[model samples]
Target: MTEFTEPEAKLEALLGIINSSARQAIAEYKKTGHGVPSADATTFHPLDLATDTLALKKATRLLEGAYHQLSAILAPPQHTVMNFVFNYNWACTNVALRAHIADVLEQHPEGLSVDRIADAVGLDESKTARILRALSLMGCFKEVKRDVFANTRLSLILKSANNTGCYAHYHSRDVSKYAGVLYETMIDEEFSRSHEVDKAPRVFACRKEGMEESFWEMMKNDDERRDIFHRGLIGHSEMMGTSSVLHQYNWGDVSSVVDVGSGIGAFSMPLAKMFPHLRITNHDLPEVMVQARNAWEENVPEALLDGRVEFVPINFFEDIPVAGKDVYYLRHIIHNWPDAEATTILHNIRKAMGPNSVVLIPSSSTHSKNLAVAPEPMLPNFGAGSHRVYQIDLTMWFLLNSKERTLDEFKTIAAAAGLALTQVYDLVETMVIEFRIAQN
Candidate 1:
């Protein structure tokens, strides 16, 4: 018989302890509705306060022991297999299979045999069964009996026709375009440069040529596809609109506001509805403006539409409509380009702004830690924030050459455009940086 190595023996011991402790914890929770405490919970250890003090510390000890054993086992050659399996399982189980299984179970509330699900979704029965089995192992669905599946809470929510079921559309083709670009860039380092317009064909050539033409091509004249894209934008806008920065703006003081790059009137329409007295001009490319008008006519409240909202076709980079307005709102637009182009967009707004006009650029920010090398702050003391924004910055690195910039970086761009940053209000992961024309 082969002798087990120290690390292997330790791993086996740790697994046993973990299984035993986990069972205890679950049993305790089920019976008493409280978790077992860590060994150091009552002890005078610095980290004791982070654990519960009432129960035995067996659970914590098992976790620490397991980590130590796993660290040894995970070194060098052993780690590659673990990493691949972990990532593969995460993508299939967490991202795809779980969602698909939940949808199937939800649609067949009476519970589904694998064949029924395959038939309903027009998938092969054998493939459907395999997917169901995989999801059942992940606790997304339950095998009620031999090859029969029933909805768990997770699966039931996935079936709803509302926001719950909307995950399918969110992860559909339109949004997946970015994901595909990112994945290809990750696998083939050469593909990284492909995202640069000069280096490769424009990825969004469909939209770059003409949004209307792109829309028809991308959606293939399919109403459902168009609606999915629209819903994804609406879902994203709803989250952004509810943020405090948007709410904190004094829209009452602004009579007319123009939303640059106002796709389907997500930001402008909401602003118009919120401030009934404030007339909003949803400006975009001619094609996008058509979509915006249709979206507004369908979704925007009638009360807000009584001459309060207008759809204007204007290429922001070329020239902004000369509207005397109190506020010029640009949301999520400036980040799409490099500083030079972004500055040009801002300059157009600066040229169009009236004296005392406020330009509200509701943008995102990033931190220094997540970068490959720490970036020098564009403005002193402006990069102070959370790591999530940095994650978004990295994401933009692949999607486009764009980035979520720090306050100082924003100020530098605004300065080039002849605008001065007056105030910045941080609201729920976004910043509303108010700017005005620089005084000569």
Candidate 2:
């Protein structure tokens, strides 16, 4: 029998993961009733429009992890390390979004000459072509012919009308600026070790530029950015497949749900659409209530007309939400604050609960060290497969001095708020954890 070396064992393990994950991914595509997508295909697969992608996400996570591991081990250390330093896809994508390059290209379906595209956008043709080419390498755009560019399925996301595009713009630009100051924040006298929202890297960056405002304050002051932000929340739901909670959980049994801090009804509106029988109350600050009402009226007009939904303005810190609802749903809310404020918000919601009412928080994977662990032969944190979740954790820190919690951390917070974890439903990207009042 031949003995395998440590490196050889690692390589074989990664190869096995890659083969299994790829097969699973292909199976997922085939289940959609459409054939698997081709790399050269110009359009999105039907699965792209799907709300439930748990299987696909699981498969891709493995595939991404295996391939990254294989590449790191197979490639030269200098090459692998330097790839991070040389990569600037975010900068290129930002330029494409900011220049409205994709929007302009939308008018030309076949393909537009690089000269015409640059001239229309008022940028130098040479520079614009360079940026597009860089993005094209990533399937975002296609060079149909030399010097002629066309939008791919991926490029559609860059259009101004796409909510995800708004989201991308916010992250690739504003968040990147905050991220640039991360090291400074770690060492700054005022910001170091602070969990306050005002001490976030975004705040730090703003202070240097002679402007300072809480994230909410800034949103309240700027109409355009605010619209983009709220719209992006909807995109965030879609990207994370948060609405899958509707299908995963037994929402049918619950009659009344209060959408706490429901920005533009990303979760609740869909809940109303899928199951029209449920009653929903939208709660937020007074200004956000205005926007939420407009969004509901526009996207889910029937819910308003049916008298099933009501908008209730709230300062959750000071106010107990409308009481006795069967469910108090807080999606993407708790992760925005530190332990003290998060507990306070939960406590307020707890104050509003009836004997049977539950608190539902939609979150990314819990960091509860004792909870779920990655499959064997995979990195404990999942390496490249968990790229987005970790980055999002950092983003919470940068944007609000907040962080994603482990299961244990969540339990502690819940305990502090006088609540107990009753159930946890694992979705593809977001987990919907349910809590009820503690008996003891």
Candidate 3:
């Protein structure tokens, strides 16, 4: 019965949303019997490591969106604008990831002095302390005592072996560089009006530095960078909680699945494990296929032995995937290219589809009003709650001249590929959009 038309009423509504969503998140944590995580906690909570975090994520989306909206409204205009312009947390996080600060702190549960920490990581003492202190403000690392620091739950994510850490590393170091030239690329004649992959801000930035290999070509040539990129992808899955689709979707109905553009089988490997009955095929370029084979051999050799999984090397732009699978799942693939290339990829997959086959694209559908929207008094796209969705869209724009699409945009591309949007599974940060052949 409450109308949220006025600014005061809306603020009250957001506060209520914040309170309710926080309680929901706490309840999810308590459901695990491990209680909620403390701000200063050094270790991960049990739920933190669990595979299905959809409930927690849902609550968190609202909680994040509401509080951030409340803050923007209450804070001074200059302060809010400056916060956007002056944020350099990415640079600080990059330093932490590259320097292995969390790995160093892991050995010191009681915390370590800045001097010892710097010496261990070979960073200058005073400057390193500044970085740690900056990150500590956001609860990443904790200043346990004067001039000493210890890892908190957030900081533990930056440890070298963590998948999500790998993702953060790549984003912070590489993507940030591309992002820096956004304005220049927008105004440049050759790049400004083109949607070609080579016209991306990344190409512009790289050209400035006299490095000229395309992103994929560069990845193909560098073994270490390629390895890190693939691992970072798994971390990307973890960060976006894309793998939660395993539990949310009805895999029981899917007997076989072709993982289109599958990098190292991040989604398929777990899918195969969870539903042993699924005949999973990974489709990627030859080099990625080799890596995917090794990953499968090392991680889930049993699935291979049982004849449940296969690796099919493909240049998805040109190659049609294996014919007639129940599901052709493209996770985080389409967003890497512009509309024309994306349409071609989907159309190629369309060629391999059987009458009943469905192409599942789990992607960041940026600001799709058809999907989740905030109630009145809050930004419709949930503002900061949907922060990653918008950022990833920009990331695509920067790196490849591509972008995350709206639901209508998705349908347009799907229609061009002779497919129609059939279903959408809203999985918090991203959604799994199901497409099938268009009817006459």
Candidate 4:
């Protein structure tokens, strides 16, 4: 057996990953000419604001993967297993987001006393202190002085304005409820065998609230929830560093692109900003189209002034996209549906493709490429470092009866839609898979 496959080499392998990955991250920071970020940094590093984070994420993947593996390997099994159950990190983060603790703390650049902070947000002093202390342990907040909390770089992400905060709010509030019922959904007669969106744990949990409609249907009907949800998608992209695709993909060669199921032009706006020559189309339901236009006007107004962008409302399962575009880009779309619906969306796009048109599914491309191959002696996909991805895979199951797919799983669906997978670009956060119309 290879050393990587041997049980004895695990610890040694982890240490190597930790050392090398940490060095890689240090190099990324130094290359930025900003040195490395301090643990107590109060604001974002310049790299944090950069659209390209391929190097940073690459280093992080290894660093995160190794440390988590080492922890799991060395820590007592009881500590690790109970961790799956006794975790209150989410609950504490929920409190921080809901209370707008980050916003309040932002006013006190130096720091704020727990009692005063609690009074400012109108929560009990001791309870606020407890939650802050808990999250502080995880680096979300800093205890500048005993019972005095300050915003850290991580805490800034929890601010009311940040998209990651919105993402967290939705997940912590709604997704958590659905997750609570995951076991019940697994064993229940009606939901157990169904892969339909309506049968999701989310719908089951909210059965009494009359959440009988599919996730998309419900989103379509509710304006407020839909707005928050779409904004969260933008936040989702930022947190995932998906904007790197603009630099990674060969957009310069493509004349035009369509963002299918586009939510407020999250991907397309940045694409348009970065590549001014490429014509862009944003497609979604009618309401979301209105949103996309407004967002484009606000964020990519230059594109609007030049009349280079178009908003086309689409129901992807039934409607073919605007035809003959160089690319039909679906960012974070297919993963929200089960095989049947996902295939239908692809089929619809397939119908729109001219001979040269390519359909791009950017979210799941890494599995088919080198990006997902962990360093030897580590679990492929980078065990603990990839913890979030696995958690998100479960999140899809809980919320929509959908999932993240392995390459083969994604290809099976693509084949069913009469498309052929043509290329794969492994962006650090997600993979961008390219497909073309199948040759019969």
Candidate 5:
């Protein structure tokens, strides 16, 4: 056995990891009976649309992590460092999404000339051509012929109808602005040390643009944006591969679930569909409750007929959820507030817990003060494998001045609410942390 303490042995170990993880990923694709996707393919592979992607995500995480580690070591340092700032894919993607470039291209699948594409989208021809070419380099759009472009599998998500595209749209349009002022916010006296909602980097950025409404207030007042934001949540779920919880968890044993701060029942809708036995309560603000009912009625009206799901309006910081639920699920909720308010939310839930009731938090582990480390010869948190997780942690900070809590931080807040951590499910991209009421 080669000792990884030496640099050469460590490099070899990473190479082995990259190889094995890649093969594992290939096997997953083959198991689907559709084989692997070609780089130049214009259509999505069957596996790309799958919901339960835990195994594939696992392999991808290691493959990405190990390969990036290897490249950083093997390649010149300047090349790697410059690549960070050189990335303008998000900007280019923003242009394509706003222009509905994919939607325009979809009508002419053979290929559309850049001039025609720009005309259809009402954009300048030369500028649009440049954007398409940049994205084509990344396989998002394909240059089928000189100055002509076609939608690739990667570009499909950018179409107006794709929910994941909505998620990308929000990030590219809104979050990118917030990110641009990260340095300014850090140095500003008012926002530098504040962790409150009003002091977030988004607030700082918006204030500079002469808009001062809080994030939720803006969402509530703007109907169009609220709709896009809700759809974006569905997109967020897909991108994170979070639906894996549907298969990974022991939902069969559970009967009732209270979806705390559940925005339009994204998680519970699928849960209710998969396990018809679950009695679900979706608790959110009064306005959101309206949207929830409409969503369920449109999507899963049968669930409502049997009384399998109920919509209850709540202000979680002050109001308590219904009593004695089998599970109080908070998906991407706790990370939206500062520690004190986060404790209040949990404490309120703790009040409604029965002896066997559990609280589940499906979150990115990147924000924790102490993440579970990877095995030897790998960067502890799986490096680039956890790229999105780390970026999400920063996103929370940018939008809400909050963060994904560390395990110790989670334990501390749970303790404050008379709850204790019982189990942790490493769902690759995000971990589902289970908490129960503390026994005195």
Candidate 6:
């Protein structure tokens, strides 16, 4: 063993003393629920591990407090590293990886060596190894050995040609088109300001010359892309849909239900299936309604499609044609606009709602303080304390100038629209804010 110098030996001795003191404190706390003074009280007053257990407890609490404080200081760097790892390559790298994995696995269902996969996908062997390593860390693939890789459950999903998996439009160039704009928005203030109105000018401008499309608009244009977008929304809905007031809602009293801005009828179709007696009308833009109608006809039962569910094409901002529905369900819609615009949308629905009708707005809650009930501590402590929701809030800010709101904010918006907040249901991260027309 290498011998230590005098300074090093002295430092080691100090650390040993500290460790002994801590251990003694812990033992005292364990034994008597308090800490006792050690025999060497003059030079090294080790904690009393016998009777003074509270001292040990206090030290443990202090250590926890210091750890959290240090974590708070280091959080920015940690977040930066994570963002660099995930957000780097503008999602193109992942798309390319998915495509290459799928192409290779299609030929060799048994499994292909790393070199063979690289050759099949037209990638350099070393570069492929690096990419595969990254993907393996992300749980997208399994590493059989040092450089060899095999398809995982996630990889298989990407390899499938059918619409079943989340990979249908994973490689869409259109999806990656907004990456540059998003990147610029992160670094440059001027570009960030411009992105507030025109999210993807290159793509959105080409599609419709001068018109600006919200982030969702570009994603919902085509079948494959719409499927991918809806899959993501379904994931989000599943997470937030738990708070849905539909269970507490009296579906028996309602004859018809209108789901406004119902994209591909994820919310409406399920309601129709749940309540066979209630007729559900899915109202959306003409393009979306076309897809919704096709999806409903193909996926829903023939009997339900015949009369129970109808796809109506209407610009909700202009006018709502169908009226007297007992329940008007709006999920993940109101949070997409500022208060004034959200109120306008709500007012239009109110115009179509009867006196006794209940309008349900299922939105993610922005209440950060209430997150004390969360089992684990939420990250960033940004307004709502949820990193996912906060990221979405920023995405909304840059894309549509909309915002996710707190419960009080929702209530205020309802009041502005001459609606009363009847009940608020908390569903995990999502909230169902039920409203009725206020009596004069």
Best by TM-score: 3
Cα lDDT of model 4 by residue, 284-362, tens digit:
8998899789888889999999999999887888888998889998887899998988999998888888999999887
Q: Name the 10 consecutive residues with the lowest summed lDDT in model 5.
A: 367-376
Collision pairs in model 1: 38-57, 39-57, 379-408
Considering summed lDDT, which 10 consecutive residues are worst modelled in model 6?
A: 42-51
Better of 2 and 4 by lDDT: 2
TM-score of model 5 relative to the true fold? 0.96
The lowest-lDDT stretch of 10 consecutive residues in candidate 4 is 363-372
Pairs with backbone N, CA or C atoms under 3 Å apart (clashes), candidate 4: 362-432, 365-431, 366-431
Ranking by TM-score: 3, 5, 2, 4, 6, 1
Question: Residues 94-204, candidate 5, lDDT per residue (tens digit)?
Answer: 999999999998888889999899889999999999999999999999999999999999999999988899989999999999999999999999989888999999999
Candidate achieving higher TM-score, 1 or 2 = 2
lDDT of 3: 0.90
> How do the residues 170-225 of candidate 2 rate in per-residue lDDT, one tens digit apiece?
89989999999999999999999888899999999999999977899999999888
Model 6, span 1-440: residue lDDT tens: 33446654634443453455467546654455334433212111232111112334333433333344334444697774675566534243455445557557656544568898888777788887777777667655657677777765545445434332342344334434443355554555544444344433343324445545556566655566676665545445443333244465667787888889888877776666667888888888787888777777777766254687887888877886489888888877887766776888888998898888888887655554443232112122322224455555654554454567877888798888889888875544455778899877
Provide TM-scores for the models.
0.62, 0.96, 0.97, 0.96, 0.96, 0.67
TM-score between candidate 1 and the true structure: 0.62
Model 2 bad stretches (over 4 Å): 1-5, 369-372
Residues 314-420, candidate 3, lDDT per residue (tens digit)? 88888889999999999888888788888999999999999999999998856676577767667777888888888988888999999888889889989999999
lDDT of 6: 0.60
In model 3, pairs of residues that clash are: none
